[model samples]
Target: MSSTAAGSPEPPSPRTVTPAVETVLAFVNTRADGTGRRELFEDGDSFADWLAEFGGFGGFGGFDGETVATDADAAAARELRDALVTVLLAHSGDEESLGEPLRHAERHLRRAGSLYPLATVVTAGGVELASPQTGVERVFGTVLAAVTTFAGSGDWGRVKACRNPPCHFGFLDRTRNGGGLYCSPGCGSQVSMRNYRRRLRQES
Candidate 1:
């Protein structure tokens, strides 16, 4: 609920229920801002709270109902999120600046992607490959699966991080041309004003 002036349009609600994209966004938006900033994954409990509230795992086929996240899991989640932000930013065309972080993220993502084991399942419609995972594996597996599916289909580009500082929130770009640059119109205006002031200073 970050604001921009008294009557400006509010930032769009963070996307948190779109299959694998949901998992990516939940981690990305963990750093809360606006009234005050707080790290949503300060610990295992907080991370678990976020998962229950917005992890969006319910639609990722099936998973173990008993698995719970740990401190290590929280740390891992943050690491993955940091790398994802870099990769997503690079996708937005800043690969030069985000190169190192992108590499670092690649390593983590590659490792996490291996946790889920693929199996051939005979569904009523036909046969297809499915990922079967449990516990921590299920948690990370669902994310990796979603990324793989989306990236292959060209929808991954629509997932992006906002450019506004202190608010690098992740959002799904639903625009016609896929040119969204901010998480909200308010953020767009904020950056616009900042650019305008810079121009004024240069002119003066």
Candidate 2:
């Protein structure tokens, strides 16, 4: 029975979506906060609620009442999120810092499932990706498809993680040079101030 914020903007129409980048955005936004401490999918019930809300917003289907997420699903989802965070950090040029998490992410990603092209239909839009699975597999498949397609389209570098700790939100870098390093100007400013204070203390 949870609802969107009181003044939240309406989600874009599903028909207008290009799922590649949008799906990745949706998956990453599931975290209640950029800090990763509050997880939207902390359990089966919570996962179900998130799936319901996210599915409606993203216009994704196949995860209705019939799909049953388990405790294992919650665990896998968290693991995947952590792995993604590690990858984002690596993307930010810290590849040497999280080798093990990256490896774990790779293995799990390998098992996520596969995508096959669906016949293009004018009504349904042009050629689209589809997967023949359900439950957690479907979730993994959708996210992986987004990541792969986005990377193939050369937008891989545009997906970035905030440099600010405890607020590592994944965002599409729409900057002219794709040099964005934080989730928002606020985060960037906070980091800047913190760094400035630290340096001042060192000098003092």
Candidate 3:
């Protein structure tokens, strides 16, 4: 939230989920993670179902016992997720095609766009006008907006993807050196050692 020469500050950036956002994101990313493959977006039915139940931000098609059972394939999920995030989260540099979490990202953005309002007005008439109402879509929009704002404004240059190759989770890389790559210090150490070992073997 830096100030411009006009003596006014820019709008705050979107960011980490506040319990509410977390709940929705939890449901959203789950399909992509697929809990290590037990559940997956393998087809249209599964994907559509997943979107309806969880991916929809708890409101895509309404709550029901239906599960995503589409013949869509893994690639479809990956694609959808990535595209959604691309729009929902600003400057999300995650445009890779058919990654592991593509469709999840798409579901995320759609619901976000559907729910979260970019701006809310608070008139001076003692009225508190709201932008994002309550729901899954709102949650996604707010969280994604926070991420997008941070990237757009270059807020502390903090937003980053995990350096751990195996765990490519995105986060606000809050490190002093701003070089924190792995999601955790332990992962960073492991990756460093692994790289060093590989180099040693290469030299031999």
Candidate 4:
């Protein structure tokens, strides 16, 4: 079994999620931060391991595990992942918690869109947008396509990153009113306690 980063928050239990949302969350959660940080794409071999596990989501395929990811490809993937995490933080209403400006994230995503443009694919069953590129570029395109699909269906807002600092895990908010702030109750309590202590310090 793959080892987790020391102090890394436990992976949340699996929940029912569409293929698109699943793809987005899987990609974004690769960077798990805690007392220590764990990056799944730290090297070419690690990147391949991650691809072997999640590259083939339903309706989004063509990523070959054998494809060697260069350092440039890994860097590009990290850029896209970080930008997506920023967007998900906005969806959770915690944009201010992180210093990353949403507009900057928007610009990065726009640049990525140009770098990995999607092609229109029409089939008898339905219309789809897919990437014509191969290898690592195709992986990037697949992730973009998933984001586009979920955003169009209005489900994009339901995906969010945890509000707690250093534990910004991505999760699907399944609450009835969609008011989920943190990934788990433990994280919520951590934030609440931190706030309470701050208030006490102010009064003291």
Candidate 5:
């Protein structure tokens, strides 16, 4: 529904049906690249702003909007976000795009898991993962819980970052075959054209 930098309308992409998927995408997209680059958790105030915007989402019930974020918390949030982007890049078969090795990213995620462990919650409706911590740590736990839940459903592979450089936007691949590579047709076209030019030069 959004237009690209060139004023072209982006093709309709599949919307995530699960709240878990929505949460993961929202968290990963906070630091999207290219012309739409955004760093939502640059500082304590900015991190607080991000919490105000997405803290009320389904899995984020433990977030305390009133709780203030420290600079340390903001830095941790950025580290977590980058690690997540690395994993999502792997999902899109572009693990090296972010320049962080996948193994390093995995280790960071493991460290994060220990820092913000998720708790199991049972209700009359069903069972779910919830964060016991409050404030920003809770936000991290909830994001991890979302990823775990969606990954358990076998749909985690569908959650991917765009393969196009400088436009590694997070998106849910809803194509029939789950072969989506780019976030939009424009990104795909850009990659194709670049590849074509490279091929021509090589042939020359």
Candidate 6:
């Protein structure tokens, strides 16, 4: 295989995520340089752990001339992570029917109505970047801030909850025609079949 020939070799495909999924993924993947973890939303536990860490601080209150109790910190972290996951996971449907993890996630996302995930700010070498301000970070301060870059932009059309029951979570429909409705194509087919069966039962 040559370096740059289709017949010789193919370049690696790029990893792509729509703006909506990226929002939640960002929260799930934030890294804490203050701690050992170097990346955020890279994995599930880390996402949960970041919430734990963020919630540790009491309402973003910095340790003043006096330091706060360690237990207070832990409690705060728990609240933020749990709240974020909870708000995001809250669904219009029967939320109680969801699995434990899904229930937790829906709870985290419910607050976001037309606007999903929300946004904040992060500075580059000099310029600042808009991002979601994960509430915990604002209370104590953080390198990244929650942002609402996607709010009220008439871009909400792409935002969609996956039709697949298993992944009923939301994602931005990124097909050129903006027709994407599942996290992945396989799930789309699964959902279509499910809907088909549902219609058949109703018709019968």
Give Cα-based local distance difference scores for all models: 0.66, 0.64, 0.45, 0.78, 0.79, 0.41
Steric clashes per prediction: 0, 0, 28, 0, 0, 46
Q: List candidate 1 segments past 4 Å from native.
A: 1-18, 33-37, 54-56, 60-67, 94-97, 115-122, 126-131
- Stretches of candidate 4 off by over 4 Å are 1-16, 35-37, 58-60, 63-65, 97-100
Runs with alpha carbons beyond 4 Å of true place in candidate 3: 1-40, 44-77, 83-157
- In what order do the candidates fall by TM-score, top score first? 5, 4, 2, 1, 3, 6
Q: After best superposition, candidate 5 residue 70: deviation in angstroms?
A: 1.7
Q: How accurate is candidate 1 locally (lDDT)?
A: 0.66
* TM-score of each predicted structure versus truth: 0.75, 0.75, 0.46, 0.85, 0.85, 0.39
Question: What TM-score does candidate 3 reach?
Answer: 0.46
lDDT of 2 by residue, 56-138 (tens): 54435656655578878887777676666667766665445367877876766656542322221232223345444566666
Lowest-sum lDDT 10-residue window in model 3:
122-131
Model 3 C-alpha lDDT per residue in residues 1-204, reported as the tens digit of each score: 112234345444334333333332343343333225234455655555555555444223343455433353335445444454333233234344245455565566566466466554344332221335443344334444544434444542344444444444445544555555555787678778998999999999
5 versus 6: better lDDT goes to: 5
Candidate 2 wrong stretches, greater than 4 Å: 1-18, 32-37, 57-59, 65-67, 94-104, 111-126
Stretches off by above 4 angstroms in model 6 are: 1-21, 28-48, 51-147, 152-154, 202-204
| Candidate 5 residue-wise lDDT, 83-159, digit = tens | 88888888888957445578888899999999999887775545678789877788888889888877766677898
TM-score of 6: 0.39
Error of 3 at 10 (Å): 14
Residue 148 of model 6, lDDT score:
28
Clashing pairs in 1: none
Q: Of the candidates numbered 2 and 3, which has the greater TM-score value?
A: 2
At residue 86, give the lDDT of candidate 1. Answer: 70
In candidate 5, list every pair of residues with a backbone clash.
none
